[model samples]
Target: MRKSHAFLLYLALSGLCFCGLLAHGLFKKQADVEHLEAKCRLARTLQLTDMCLFTEASYTRHLSQADLHTAFQDYPMSLDHFPSGAIVPPPEIVRRTNGKVD
Candidate 1:
């Protein structure tokens, strides 16, 4: 009977620990969603792309049109977009009817 009581106590403690971990995960997920929503709102207000909605913990950054262009250009050359390889060449902008980038 004593052994059964100890086993039940151990099981109850394990269940409580599992519940705590689950609650922590839920809280973390909710925080992430809230963070993304805030980012999306900022993107809409700034006329930025939806790529601006996601934040990378490894490389947090404020979004800009030029930054988005640079990232897209770099993505093809990168291995997971880790920001540590093959530099992107400068864009060749020809923005006029006369093909003038200057």
Candidate 2:
């Protein structure tokens, strides 16, 4: 009878521990889902902003083209100049291995 009681006690403790682990896993999964949902919302907002910028750029380019054509017809001899002082050298690349740069 004592052996049977000890076995029952062990079974009950094991079952409780398993339940605790299962609850912890479910909670972690819920947190992960919430994090992913937040990221998805942020991505959607960024896409909408990018679409708006693209639309604005398209309109601006169309207006600029029309103005340039009108100006060319009115003054065919005008020339635009680029400033020579704006040139800059590109940066050199450095290689790295195992998170350390040599």
Candidate 3:
């Protein structure tokens, strides 16, 4: 009986710890949502208010863009595909945000 009681107590503590970490993660994710919301709003000004543009997929894609840029920057073959004088642009805030560039 005592062993079972101790096991129950351990389970309770483990559950509480898991809940605490979940809450922390959700709170941190809110900032990511807000950042993406702001970027989406900017895109909206450019008439890019498509449903996907404001969705989580777009946010995650943008988040990964910088990483992709970094990975490709080191590869000489990547730039060789584009024109010699053409400069690769920075990672976009979101897709289609550069549609109006001169």
Candidate 4:
């Protein structure tokens, strides 16, 4: 019942809980594969784009589809209006092209 022992016990329990969650998710994902595949097929048929990551600004919501300037729509020196803009880096295409559209 010492402080160190108590902290060690808490860490052990947290590790066990983390492993249990990972195992559960692995099995659950296996069971849901068919359903997920069906959803993906439907999306393909509907010509859906990549899944939305952030729901703040349009640029943050769909980074892949957003133009580089969308983040600076207000002005050239305008700060990002959405926190997600700071969190998510510009898309690979924008980075590769250096913000130049093809």
Candidate 5:
């Protein structure tokens, strides 16, 4: 009836909706895990490499194949030209080996 009570009710409903969406995603993904695993296995069987994440730059296209200096090619402190550079981090192998592929 009151403004404060209405606001509280709205907050409660929104929170419930958020929780419901999260639960739906969790369950749906769990159900799809088997299908995803099968696809992964098929990809491995075909020797398929990782999917391209960003089409802007060669380094951004396939992170695993990118060398360390490609990102800083312009200069040491040069800002990234591709927006995806900020979004996708260097792969773990690149970080562990400091960009040495072997």
Candidate 6:
């Protein structure tokens, strides 16, 4: 009976350890996914900003008003402010607010 109890105790401990390891792995995977997602979001924002800036710079260099108009037509600029709903918080802003960019 004592040997049987020992066996049962060992089994329970092993099960508990397995559960702990599984939880740790899941937590790690979740953290990695969140980090990658943040990086992707930052990259997207940078791409959009770069495109807008490049288009604006191109528009500024034209010698003729007609050429400027033509360029502007090809790459239209929106004068409206970015909607709050659509704006992703920049990494810097996220860092400032959360004390970590996460």
Best by TM-score: 4
The alpha-carbon RMSD values of the candidates against the true structure, listed in the order shown, are 10.5, 19.6, 11.8, 3.7, 4.2, 15.6
Q: Higher-TM-score candidate among 1 and 4?
A: 4
lDDT of 3 by residue, 51-100 (tens): 33322233223433433344245464664233421333444552355455
Worst 10 residues of 1 by lDDT: 89-98
**TM-score result, candidate 3:** 0.35
Model 6 alpha-carbon miss at residue 80, Å = 60
> lDDT of all predictions, in order shown?
0.55, 0.48, 0.56, 0.85, 0.85, 0.52
* lDDT digits (tens) for residues 1-102 of candidate 6: 699999999999999999999999999998899897887798797753232222233332221212323323434773323232123223333345446534
CA deviation > 4 Å runs, candidate 3: 49-102
Per-prediction TM-score to the true structure, in the order listed: 0.35, 0.34, 0.35, 0.69, 0.62, 0.34
Candidate 5, residues 1-102, lDDT tens digits: the string is: 999999999999999999999999999999999999998998899886668558888887877787768768799999888898888888766687875665
As for candidate 3, its clashing pairs are: none
Q: Which residue pairs in model 5 clash with each other?
A: none
Query: Candidate 5's C-alpha lDDT?
Result: 0.85
Off by over 4 Å in 2: 38-102
Query: Model 4 clash pairs?
Result: none
Error of 5 at 53 (Å): 1.3
Better by TM-score, candidate 4 or 3 = 4
